[model samples]
Target: MDIATIDRRRLIGWGALLPLAALAGCAAGPGGYSLDEGVRRLLTLSTQRAFGRLLQPGGFYEDQLARISPPDAIGAGGPGRLNAIFGAFLRSEAVRRRVSLALNDVAGRAAQRAAPYVLESIRGMFTADAVRTLRGGPQAATDLLHQRIGGHVVEVMVPELAGLLRSDLLSALSAAAAEQTGIDYLELGRTVAEQAADGIFRVIGREEAAIRADPAATRDPVLIALLRR
Candidate 1:
């Protein structure tokens, strides 16, 4: 058989097997979890993995996949833009790296704070409205996650981030910022927390999309089965 024919046969086989897997998982569970429960568990697992990856050393600051930098709050044609004006040292590679490290540190701290609450928050997201949207497409669950729990994550995250900001390489960032704005550490900490929270959510959403697109990634046999349905 040609490549296309072989691929087609494999697809057919998976389609046939997936529902059986789902049924087996759902039926054999301790209390017989609902399909929504299965989906929620899968999403929680995916989100945990996705955010956890970002907390590793170099995961955010050095990994090309997750690295982030300070926002360009400065706009075009500003004094700093054309004249290479004051505080230009803040843009130095060293300063940028320090800032990046600080941001990543804040994210890691925030993520740790958010961890215990993550599953519960996600479980709560499957409201009637959200369940209806889940059938919309791959992004529905993630969208609901953001809409429902994003703020809570940020709220939980910011204070932890703020606390850590002073200790986790905060001095380096503070020094960098001192040159520019005397470093409103709390305000800066909040911004960092918000950005980090946003980044983690984005990562989790991407992971959810991946699992939805490829049912096998759900890993739970029941979840795979439900996806087939």
Candidate 2:
């Protein structure tokens, strides 16, 4: 099923989404092209919106997509450093504000860019029984959410923010290590997002290569043969 087809309204019932609205206008542009610039804008908006949702009342409390409430397998010192990392990452004063703004932007301006691609990511989400791509551990799933949606957001939003604030975020990311306080949610997110982005590019490359190598394999071979005649 398509991500868009997933009961977005039902998400509200999950009681984890809060009352958020998407921003922007329209899903695509001329010839349905999702220009890089447009995609960047939408990515920014969508990520911010997701961030806001995490902050909303019970926002990141229980939603499967963004849950951070740790797992039993990670009880206390049993997991050692891994357990502490999630805690440090979770303490995000900077993320609290920026993420909140971004989430709202996404809710309001969902279509201003390319909904199909985002939706594609959500929909393609293991529409089959696949192995867990990575061990997110406790709240790793929500971390996945951030990764899937963060960078495009950074690409668009970092430019809009003051240089100082941008520096702070970069700083926060850098200082994520030695997170003696708790899990470095921001850093954790960066790692996940980076990995996801890599996968996305790989898929795109493979598809492009396949299409170039055998147009017929990627298209309706019967139709292509008839056209050749």
Candidate 3:
């Protein structure tokens, strides 16, 4: 057979076997444990743990990696003379600290409200490539998940985060800042949501990497089997 014909035959063979391979991967372990189940469990555990940490008071504020800082425009010059004055005002150390605290607080509260939406996204987005994902790099699962659903998570989070920003304890400060700097709070919400999602995924990726490095630490047979090198 010519090269094209040979390639076509190989494609046909793999296509025919794909379903059986998927079924076997899904029902391979003891008690009918499946790659799907293992992946879901891992994702659930990681998400829950990440959210749990974020839900704590000052969680985002206390963690350097997770903390939300003031928007750059607040420090950098904006469109006009009024913006420059407001930027100067906000650049003061004390005022900037308060703004940073407020942002982090809003992020933490938003995270509390966002957990369900995130979990729902995960449930909806996971595909049938669990085996390859598990066998890939430490962040393979997290990378895949974020690739598929990060934008969705951020989209869902923006409005909720905006609402929280409006109602948070620092609402007055946020309002003044928004008004003076000509920064739209809704845009601020989007920024916070994006950073919040980044922190969440960072935690989840760490958990996944740890589990892959030491599958026995999970103490879950399904994960151990599937993630074991």
Backbone clashes, each candidate? 1, 29, 0
Please give, for residues 1-229, the per-residue lDDT of candidate 1 as tens digits.
Answer: 6433443344334333322222333323324555556556556766666655665555566544445566544223454542353246456898767767777766665665665566556644444542354455776676777777777787887777667766654476544444444344466567776766677767777777777677776566655765553
Best first by lDDT, ranked: 3, 1, 2
| Candidate 1 accuracy as lDDT | 0.59
lDDT of each: 0.59, 0.34, 0.67
Q: TM-score of the candidate numbered 2?
A: 0.26
TM-score per prediction, in order, is 0.70, 0.26, 0.78
Q: For residues 1-229, what per-residue lDDT tens digits would candidate 2 score against the true structure?
A: 5343343433323323221222234332233422222233222233334433433444333334433322212212335664465344436766444433333323222222222334344432321111131111322333454466646733432222323222343454344442333433343333333333333333333333333344355353321232221
TM-score of 1: 0.70
**Model 3 worst lDDT run, 10 consecutive residues:** 14-23
**Candidate 3 per-residue lDDT over residues 1-229, each given as its tens digit:** 5433443344334323222122343545435666665666567656665666666778788876678877765322355754565566566898778777888888876665566766655554445677787678888888887877787777777887777776662463555655555555577789899998888788778777877788888786767777766
Give the least accurate 10-residue stretch of model 1, judged by summed lDDT.
14-23
lDDT of 2 at 198: 38
